[model samples]
Target: MKHIKRFIALFFIAAVLSGCKEDMVTVSYPEYTKAFRNPMKGFREYFGPGEDKIRAEYPYPYGSMTKEYMQWNMIEDDSSDGIDKIIAYSNHRWKGVEDINMKVILRVLLVWVEPWHGGKAKDPNNPDDLNGWHWPKGISPQVSPYKQIPGSVGAYVDPKDKTTPIIGGYFDPAFPERVAKLVEKIGQAWDNDPRVAYVEMGIIGEWGEHHDPDLSTYWPPHDEPEHVANRTWVPGMEKVLGDAFTKAFKNKKVMVRYAYEFKDYEFGIYWDSWSQPQEQVRGYEEMKKLGDRWKTQPIGGEITWNWGDLAKFKSFEQVVADKHTREYTIEQIRNLHCNHLGGITWANFNDPEFRKNAEILQKAMGYRFILSDFTYPSEIKNEKPLNISFKVVNTGSSPFYYNWPVEVSLLDAKTHQKVWSKTLDNVNISDWMPGDDWTIEKEAYQKPAPINEIKSSISIDKSLPDGEYIIALSVLDPAGMLPSLRFANENYFEGGYHPMGYIGVNKKPGKAMIDKSLFYDIQSDKTLRYNLNNN
Candidate 1:
């Protein structure tokens, strides 16, 4: 009797997973292989249309763009020959843009300006139009005319022809080693160039966004003392431009348009006045003393009333047209921890309700992981070892600064290919920030301690191969480890490779086929509904 029908199907799955560990939910699900959207995360394009048409018009999974490239005559001519044509036009505008894996967000403007509220330093009927550089008029490194250079131009000492008090152009005195050798040739040509995601630490002033390009000639200037010079918001030059963009981006992400005075260096705060609800809570109290430097830096910004009112917004006719102006722009993108914004040069994509109020705040921006519960062991033995348990939660707001590599693979089930892989390497996910004990807000909250109980035990790279395979999970992006992240879950498959069930490779091929699809039965353990913006 075939071993009593295999002990009645292993005692009917250990009595349906220990029958009701107090109502243990289990509603038949075992079938998957489709749910993918990983690229990088929302709204970032100022010069759009390509990157798969802005990820098919915003599926928000990577595809950013930026390019300032004036680098002050290639940083006063130490010229790394325009840093290899700006990394060969950023690797030829993302050569074959890997199905939306493009990246870029580079911003190298070593000072800029044109009619900067004050102009005519030249170009009067083309007095060789700026090709005859004469920067001394209203200094602020706000001089450009395409990095002037005729006669190797230089003749503008007029601070009223100083008897000894010159303070002009790029504030001479070896301008911080010419902006630290252009931040060491931009970390020797785009650090970790997996096309790079964020960079904007552009050597000061205009469009770089970090204040003081003579901040409108010192307006309310009496907080007095920014390393004295009667303050132009320059105290310790934000640790010399946050230690030169934390030593030239150790793997992308630098930001810095604001957060007023680089809150003591863990940089990653930007906000070009997008819906100023109290300057977005004073930019979250300017990083309330840095506690959670938005976990590994990256807040993102741009949108001071443009992008056509965020793509002609509607959120159900602004909940009767005026709901506190879309709840003060969704509480500044859910409490100012935005992860990329300013899509296609300020929203309003020919208005279609800007992707429906950007899917109601891109489902709360920044992190969004879900994968409620997962357990493995459907039969494996091709040089194997597999023990998994996942319950991930961080529903998004911030957290995911790097520690990016969390694999698991096995494909072939009908030629999907892959087969076996690993890489959990003690997963940390940058302490998985965000929280969800639930709270529309009323302070003194403390419930956010539970939901994140991720446990793992993966390994399966053994030599022999035998049969069925289709299990997936990936998080990689350590500058192109591939599997780009985007797991709010639906059992992803395509590029992000998520699948999550079906295995029977070399041995233990008897039982086990558990996979709670939309999490069935519903007994107790559930809380991983990662919102889902446009599914």
Candidate 2:
């Protein structure tokens, strides 16, 4: 009996040892995490380094010149109190708009509503130099203005303007109404009354500078604390102005500017008054309400705030932290959840340093803003010997330098086949100054067998079989010769759109044909010469 018991105990011990060994045994598992990668990091890896690096195929003259329009620059000087400077600037901007296939623009500085002397174009109704009435002014010398409201002509107005020169506020009563009148007069001057791209006021001025400190001052019978507690402007300012402007322009999208910039992968936010985040929220809320009515928009600007400027700070750590604070402030503003969130404007165009910051920030932020007109050419046509000419304009506030490669293709109208192909390389365009116009001219094949080069008018070759043909053009921005991502984006500016032009043919020709002249009369009409025999 004792031996049997001992045997059972031995068997139990062996089973326990086997179980421990099994628990300690190593097991094999896949090494990969199998998680998704970040999209931004992926984009960076794919594109390599720097901004505005896009690969595009540039086609030539046979393709239409997509960006064949022109531009004019007009600067407003603060020193000149007389309207002469303003008038001259306006005329210079519109110098050839009426005679060209382009749009007219008048750029000006947004300052306070102050008195000014009138020039030759005086108001016939108010003969007492009514144009000199005190106008709305912008706070802070830092805000950079780019957009305009339809009613104010091309000028941006501040909601806070007064008759006196106070530190932070405007002195004008009914400031909103005054701005509306300004917009109306300006629009009438351009024959487009009350311009629609209405006033984009910058939110950087010190709180309670232009008007009273309490919300009750602007909004009569101010009773609601909900509207008063953290309001930027008085309770009713935006409501009244937004309503009036919307009624007149019939368009929503009121412009509200914010200081926005990106540094070291983070966004920086600053207002005219860094002390009043609550007031800033009030202003943002007003604009948000307006945007809710139709489509609200937030126009972000890259105001000048350099960490290098803050070198006096105790340590580089503090300076970097401050810079980071600015970026975080903007992120907080975006979190406010307003509609029509407009893109950022990288302030002064002439500064190269500003461009560098804009480039990186635009990529990191995933936001977009317009750079006016930046498209390549679209269509090109020829008779026998052909010459093509077009213009490119830098509508943004900076210069654009890039090599344009042009390709010319002749298509068969009947069979839809390519008969001739030629690519022009290393076409260098000198500095395209902001708001300045530049032209491009090229001459291609000159064989005029089917038509006479002189007697026949300029027309596309129609001598291939009975089929439709088109000439196309594209551009490759390998060197990143354009502006930052904001200006170079395909969605924001036409500057990056490839394959902009095309030409078509119908049948074989038997007569002399003339080339299309690039000349335009004062009325802005095209002069075309063609041969009936080719058709």
Candidate 3:
């Protein structure tokens, strides 16, 4: 009888332990099927002052911003004008951009060269034939002294007309000071603006690319002793502009044309000739030397198909269609950890094969966060600390670059409406890093992305009611506390939140109430929406 009693007691203890184990649940979510557009990453479109709408034949399926080249002359034509005019001009340029749910990557350029207007006529002698070199009212070649080249000749003389001189302000002593003032004024207007995504530290060279007069082969080579000096970047110019931009814009990320420049500053790189075969020296190799800089600063640029070796591919479609080139391009993007790209803005995505390939490329460019696992207790007592944990993985080439807030909420089981929500203070989404060191042979990152495990204990709201609720998670953009980033998970709800499992508040946990069928139905109207004044 004593042995029987001991056996029964041991059995009861074992059963209790089993019951306790069942109270905690660990759920694993599958990755989503398709790639979708997110803010501040992926391909970008071209935008200008009058162009308010995207004009692609088949609009990009995965982009969120427009790259606008803001001519310096357009913003501040006269040095005597007050800063108000510059502010007003910028505000007007982005007036309708927010309505389309897009941001602007602004580049304030001093020159634009031929084909695109901002300058004097190609035939400088003929005022009737206008071109794209836009020198401001007080800073024209006619007024400023050109000392970079000998004999008082301009640094960039017209190829067609040797007599006509196209001056770059880099050699002028007054140019840097004027640019500093302009940058300061721009910062005051755009640093806090929500519409602006990133600012290219432009103000030198043509198209703000930082290569002209000095490094340009655009005109016939002038090998004369005086012109030889012109084939180099202006001394101390990088530091001057780098310091100005760093001091001026505290909130926004700034990018320069090359990674080799601005070594002292923590500026990003915008490689104008991304993926070009011939750019191995100064472009591709230079960016590769930056090492892990892309982890913090954005690495973006246009894959030019109109010029260089890229033009040999004929069209953007062919560039990605050929297996060798396509693989090489993807390898470069992953290796460099590119955040955004252009050149595909004008690509015709009407072709099914091209569209499919483009989708793969889009997913490879920016941060694609995946919530692989979520664990929580079945029951939570009101006013008690509720401990929950989750694991995230970024499979894309680059990080999100911003430390946005992650929100946890309890939704009404019946209506799928949020009953209670709290933004998790512990999770820094930007630190959820992607993989690195891509290898073409393996077609994968040498170091696979690690699972970012986030464990947090949150306070449960004290309420009188006791009922079942569906637990959910979301990432807010902070612009309006709206859910803007969607996780690449199969458990995603239509309203930008991912529904985990069911839980009970101040009661015994009920059966799992998360109906996968209702996932498609809009649960809330307060979805991911963007507006200029949201900041």
Top-scoring candidate (TM-score): 3
Candidate 3 per-residue C-alpha lDDT over 180-222 given as tens digits, one digit per residue, 9 for 90 to 100: 8888888887888777889988767667787654433222332
Q: What is the lDDT of candidate 2?
A: 0.27
Task: Tell me the tens digit of each residue's lDDT in model 2 across 1-535.
Answer: 9999999999999989875431111111111111111101100111111222323321110111111101111122232224344445445433432221122212122322222111123245532222221223442222221124444423232434221122222223444454455434333333331111123322112211122223233332122222222232344443443344344432322233332211111111112222124444544444333322211232322222332233344432232235454354334333332111111221232355543433333322222112222122122224443333323332222222222334434544333345664444433422332221112121111221121011112344444444334332223222222111112212211222211123433332332111213111211112111121222
Alpha-carbon local distance difference test for all models: 0.52, 0.27, 0.74
Which should have the higher lDDT, number 2 or number 3? 3
Which candidate would rank higher by TM-score, 1 or 3? 3
Give Cα distance to truth, residue 409, candidate 1, Å: 9.2
Candidate that would win on lDDT: 3
**Worst 10 contiguous positions by lDDT, candidate 3:** 216-225
Arranged by lDDT with the best first, the candidates are 3, 1, 2
Model 1 lDDT on a 0 to 1 scale: 0.52
Deviation from native of the Cα of residue 175 in model 1, angstroms: 19
Off by over 4 Å in 2: 1-89, 92-180, 189-198, 201-240, 251-253, 256-298, 301-357, 364-497, 500-535
lDDT of 3: 0.74
Better of 1 and 3 by lDDT: 3
Q: After superposition, how far is residue 254 of candidate 3 from its true place, in Å?
A: 1.1
